[model samples]
Target: MTIQQRKSYLIQVGAFLSQFKSSGIEKRLDLACNDPFFDQMLEQIDMAVHYNGWFTRENVLFSLEEWDKALSEENLEKWLKSYNFQEESKTVGLVMAGNVPLVGFHDFISVLLSGHKVLVKLSSNDKKLLPILANYLVSINPEFSDKIEFTDGRMNNFDAIIATGSNNTARYFEYYFRNKPSIIRKNRNSVAILTGNETQEELKLLAEDIFRYFGLGCRNVSKLYVPQDYNFDSFFNAVLPWAHLMDHAKYANNYDYNKAVYLMSEFKLLDNGFLILKEDPGFGSPIATLFYERYTNKDALLETLQAERENLQCVVSQDLMESEVSYGATQHPKLWEYADNVDTLTFLQNL
Candidate 1:
């Protein structure tokens, strides 16, 4: 299929996705293949929730809503304008990550849009959603039927590979796909730099960045870099709205267990019933807790952040650095905001 054909098919999928919202699913009669695929898509989302404890209905719908915005005709055109597509197609292997809903959809689409076929190995945590979406795309055009394939076991017979996993698994990917063109992603955490001058509104928005998806996605801010003598009163108060998260059984269990361990270890902690703030230098934090470090010198902190860039997926801040993600905006990344700062489309185009 031509690039234009691929783009058109994807835009239709985006329109279909736009119908599913957090409030409820609204079936639009005008949508193509609405009768057959619309209800099936909804059932798949429900199945996803039953299959994975982390795949809450609200979170899954939020992911779909974000993609709906991303695949709009304008956004798609603007994002793809900078890339040149190749005429020949190759088979691209995808080992998807299931930390969050539809986490690997970007790579899936990138391969297709670059005029390549995709062989997918779905993460068990997120197996249902993508295949149904792939089917929806195929329903849009029968030509897409030959381009998509999913394997539950080993992934092979592909020209290139795109895999996401922990740092340990990344090493294995590097060695295994050594001779092939690939993009191998590793563990990354997002952090926020607090200057002690943020508005209440901004701090509240920052709470969204920290707690959304139960702080499971890489884009979720798990750590904070605060100025020396920074106070926690305002920050804690601003994030009070998310206290409802404590009602989630899984999250509550984690909070209880971590709180017990912290108390037993006699570590200093600032707790507000639902969330805990601990003074730590680490970027990744446990569930129900956030790590923070104090910096007295701005220049020193900048140097440290620059040095540890590979360990970070995003730096949430306000006017602190170039390319820093704004408060609460990390999760709603644009289509071109490639993960690990690696350009997937560029990788596919070259392949």
Candidate 2:
């Protein structure tokens, strides 16, 4: 496909998304909620925007605009034209994760845009959403249909590979994709450093950083580094208004289970519905747990974080202008950037 061809495809997708209420995608999300496989994933997305009140209609529209513009002709002409091909057909295997909504969607988007075949192994935890979205793409232009496929079996025929999983799974991917050109995603935690001077409203928004997706995503805030002698009570109070969400059976289950385990083993933890409060220590990932430590010296904390930068993807704290990652944006990843540091279009271009 040429630049113009990809442009046409993106514009069509843009039109459908921009007019989502009138398009099948919105209806698709509604109908997708029925799938037992995706019911939980659907609930998380809907509730994240609602419970925290982050996903306004305005935000929804903004997402469509952003996605469209990211894939627009001008951007693609610059960003993707060199990546496009005429008859090149590489079987790119994709191993996706369900940590958050469409966690590995960029792999699919890149493979499709670059005219490559995909063998996607959808995470059992999130199987339905991607297929539904892919159906929309295939429906838009059936010819592009042959360019994509989904699979869970061995990707021995794959010419290249991309897999998203935990640090442990990365070991397996390293062994598996050793013989193939591959990009493997490893476990990384996101953190936030608080100055403790934020407004009540700012603190409330930061709470969203912890609770969204029940803190299961890689981008969700897992550990918070705060100034010395900070008041944890005030932060808790600011977020207390959202206590109703704790009643959610799924979230409560994780909270209760973790709490019980902590009590039994005396792991030293804090409790607040879906989040566990810890004075220090960054859990491997933020799933259903929020922890923080006090640090008066920003310079000292920055040095500590930088030393461990290899294992970190994002810093979810206030704009320190020193951390490599953005705070609170653990979720809103653009189309071009894949997990952590992998840039898909750039990879394809250099390939």
Candidate 3:
């Protein structure tokens, strides 16, 4: 199919996904292919939670909502307006990540929108949702069936590849795909730069950045760069709204286990029953824990962050830097916000 046809199919998929939200599932009469696909989609959501404890109903719906917002006609037009797609279709192999629901969807859509076929190897943690949507796309237009393929075992017979994994797995991908064009993504964590002058409202929004998806997404703020001698009382109080996260047994178990490990090691910690803050210079923190470093100078902190940019997925702040994402907006990225600062559509087009 043509690029426009592919985008039309995706817009329909987004419409289908928009029905399943955190508030409630509202199946509209105007949606196409609602007969068995709608009920099947709900079944897949339940199965997602059953297979992976991390894929809660709220988190999965949040992901769906974000995608729905992204696939609007305006957003897609703005995103793909500049790309020139006059190339022959090639099969692009995609190795997806399962850290959060539909984590690798951007690459999946990019390959299709760039007028290429996609061979996908689904992450075991997120195997169900995408295939159902792919089926839905086929139901909308049979052309998609020729364009999408999912493999459980080794992925081959593709022109190029894009793989997302941990830093170690990235090295393996690079070596394995050395002869072909590829984008090998490594582990990256998002961080927030907190000035002492931030308003309580802003800090509360920052809480969303930290706690959303139970802090599992690469865009989730796992570390904080705070002013020296910054008091924790205000920050902790601002984030109180998310204390209900303790209700999740998996998160609570992680909180207890991390707290025990910290206490046994005599590490200094600030605890609020649900989340823990530890003074660490690291970017990636354990679940239920946030690592923080104190910065004495703003200019020096910027330099340090610039030096570590490659290791960061996002730098969230309030007008602190030119490219910084806003306080609560990291997880709600725009359609053009390519992960790892690598343009997937450009990569696919070049291939």
Q: What TM-score against the true fold does each predicted structure earn?
A: 0.98, 0.80, 0.98
Best by lDDT: 1
Sort order, lDDT high to low: 1, 3, 2
**Candidate 2 residue 66 C-alpha distance from true site, Å:** 8.3
Once model 2 is optimally superposed onto the true structure by TM-score, how far is the C-alpha of residue 33 displaced, in angstroms? 21
Question: What's the lDDT of the predicted structure labeled candidate 2?
Answer: 0.65
lDDT of each residue in 1-351, candidate 3, tens digit only: 667777888899889888999889998789888768889888877777888999988888899999999998889999999988964579999999998999988988888888889999999999888888888888998877888999999987999999999999999999999999999999999999998989998999999999998999899999999899899899999999999989999999999999999999999999988999999989999999999999999999999999999999999988789989998899899989999999888888888
RMSD of each: 1.0, 6.0, 1.0
Show model 2 residue runs off by greater than 4 Å: 17-87, 267-270, 322-327
lDDT (CA) per prediction? 0.92, 0.65, 0.90
lDDT of 2 by residue, 1-351 (tens): 664675577655554443333132342343321344234334444444443332333333344444645655565566554554554578788999866545666688777776677788988666654675566666666776787788777666788888889889999999978988888888887777788787787778777766665667676678888887787777887778658656566666767777787779877776656567766666463345677788768888888888877677777655675544454455555554456777776665445
Clashing pairs in 3: none
Instruction: Please report the TM-score between candidate 2 and the true structure.
Output: 0.80
